[model samples]
Target: SSVSVVICSGDSVFLEGAYQYSAGTYFDTLTGGNNCDSIITTILTFASSDSSLTAASICFGDSMLLQGAYQTTAGSYVDSFSNAGGCDSVVTTNLTVSSQLSVQLSSDTTIVTGGSVVLVASGGASYLWSTGDTGSSVTVSPTSTTTYWVNVSDSLGCLGTGQVTVTVLPAEYLVYVPNVLSLSSVNLEHTRLYVYGRGVESLELIIYDRWGKKVYESSDASATTRSDGQCCAYGIGWDGTYKETGKPLNSAVFVYKLTGLFSNGKEFIESGNITLIK
Candidate 1:
């Protein structure tokens, strides 16, 4: 009589008072009830075992199932399952967890009308701004206070977002005065000390030296609209010189008083110090 049996690798099956491990045929001799020798044939085979290795990744704050367990960190893991022959079907997992996505903008800021501000975003592989811009930095000139948003993505497709508010200063009797003047530069605009502003229908500018004596004064009411439609009062700027003579003035600090009237007939006044550098 012949019999067949299957077992797993590294395991044995008992047959005819002996253990069988490898796939082969064996012969056993046993005595029958009639006292005659009986021959027994045993066929042994090995069952199929399974092993696999896999690599997986998950975003931060996310989980993945492996070996009937949830993993959230980066590392290697192993699991075992029983096959039909009760063998260990081993599975190895090499998992990697990505870092959390974070995005930061430059700052929420304020800018004068007709002026532009640069907004920057960091800690991202790609960026998309609300202005339909796709760069990490964008320039915006909003007519009014506005909020801008940016969407960022990492190489792993992880997403993050950031926003900034830009406050646009309203039109008023505004003026810009320079504190320093450079005479060495060839640029005429550099040497000329000009007070720039908007909404001024009439302007009076006076400059005084260290002494109380006034060195220059202007009542020029000439105003022109800039290309951007903002009014700029030209009013004959000073050229680092005395009004009496066309000679240049020495390097020193000078005090100035500026008074004006807006187009709406509102009064405006300001005083500041200026340094003339030769």
Candidate 2:
């Protein structure tokens, strides 16, 4: 028996010639297990393989594989290969690598002149900061307005920098006292008594004689004889008199003490001398 068929180019079924395969109709003859003659016909088809594409993204120092080779650089590549289906294949590869470097830092901040603040830095592999800190965050207290810088590095050896500023304001709890007093002797208008401080919550003024006896003491909710610019727009003082006696205190050198609480709830203490002159 005979068979006929149309085969494409470059294909064959017989082990006949130097060509691996060619498009043609072929026949094979073999003896079966029963020693009987068996005839078989085969048809083959072949065509050029299509061009292929591959993409890649690799880390800094890693290699990009293209064209059956490891390439350290990034670029377009092409390679020819023989497909298992007996076709010539052309592959086109476009590769990319990760080499970007970036860093982030927290924004500017303001704090009380004596307060502290925390600085935040990004997730860099390593860091160096101007405040001598090497961690991702640090605590700082700047006496005045200060700017801090940080140097950061990634695993790929790329470096980036970030900066932040901290501003310091004047303290709210400020205290001031005069060194001398006329003790109501200069004039009736000069007898105004007050203790001067800023942002004070409550105040206590105590006067002591030479023997440490508490001769005069005034307390919270002090009255502002005149605005001497104390906390709460109020003032604190004693009227040159004794606490135990209604008589005016003698004109002499006397010790005075001032104790108060700041607006932020901190304690304040101060002591000084005032010369009570006639």
Candidate 3:
């Protein structure tokens, strides 16, 4: 025999020899309230489950992969997953993104003294140089070696600083001395020979007659220090005259000794014969 009964959705009922009962009717043998053999039935029902979660934050211009798919736009996404109940569960994800920050400066460079070079900054909304300027590029001419720094701010208000060193090369040295000078007429003071070069520290020239007698000498030629700190550059020189009376020397071949010091601490000594015209 069969009996009918109502049950809530997803609920299960039992039969005589079965544990699971579907939406169909079942028969069971039991001692009804009358203590006699009777039949009863049960039915079962089930429902689906789902869930939602927020995804972690990610940087701008970067993508996130979910369930073998890539996504960049910020929004809600859904994918099916197997739950412990052996059912397909729907999972929703909400994504959040942020902006990226970057900053950089030009590489280091080498320059000679009195020479200038341009430095550039990049990957920023604004820039400020250590030299008190605000711009994307700056020109620097340092007497000696120096390092310059630039502070950069990104669109997201992120700040970064970078530096580049500028190495300065020493000044060049060059000089020229005349082999002969006239001491008579218009050549009096014009005959004076001053050290000449791009960087002359100090120079001293002495004159002597054929007899080896010192005819002219100026300052301490051996002094390590020069009043003018440049190489091949000095205003002091010999006027082709005697040391005592400032008298012009006679027209003759005279032996001269020259000692020069350079700004770089290098020294040179030269001795040669110079002709004097009377």
Q: Which prediction has the highest lDDT against the true structure?
A: 1
Q: Model 3, stretches more than 4 Å misplaced?
A: 1-171, 185-189, 220-233
- The TM-score of candidate 3 is 0.32
RMSD of 3: 19.0
Q: Please list all clashing residue pairs in model 3, or write none if there are none.
A: 10-45, 10-46, 199-231, 199-232, 200-230, 200-231, 200-232, 200-233, 201-230, 201-231
Estimate, for each residue in 1-278, the C-alpha lDDT of model 2 and write its tens digit: 45544332445444333343666555677789999988766554456466788886665567866778897777888988777655667788887766755678987765667889899899589889997889989999998989999998877555778999886656765554566767545564345356665666787878789889988777654434334343432453556777746578778888888787767776666687877765
For every model shown, the clashing-pair count is: 0, 5, 10
Write down the TM-score for model 1: 0.53
| lDDT minimum window of 10 residues, candidate 3 | 219-228
Q: Quantify how close model 1 is to the true structure by its C-alpha RMSD in Å.
A: 11.0
Model 3 lDDT per residue over 6-123, tens place:
4433455555575553566556778878899876554334444556676665556777886658887777777877666555677777877665555677776655578899999998
Candidate 2: how large is its RMSD?
18.7
lDDT of 1 by residue, 112-197 (tens): 68989999999889999999999999999999889999999998887889999887755764665678878786766667676777
Greater TM-score among 1 and 3 belongs to 1
Candidate 2, residue 12: Cα displacement in angstroms equals: 99
Give the best candidate by TM-score.
1
Could you tell which candidate, 1 or 3, scores higher by lDDT?
1
Q: Residue 76 of model 1: what lDDT?
A: 87
Clashing pairs in 2: 10-22, 10-23, 11-22, 11-23, 12-22
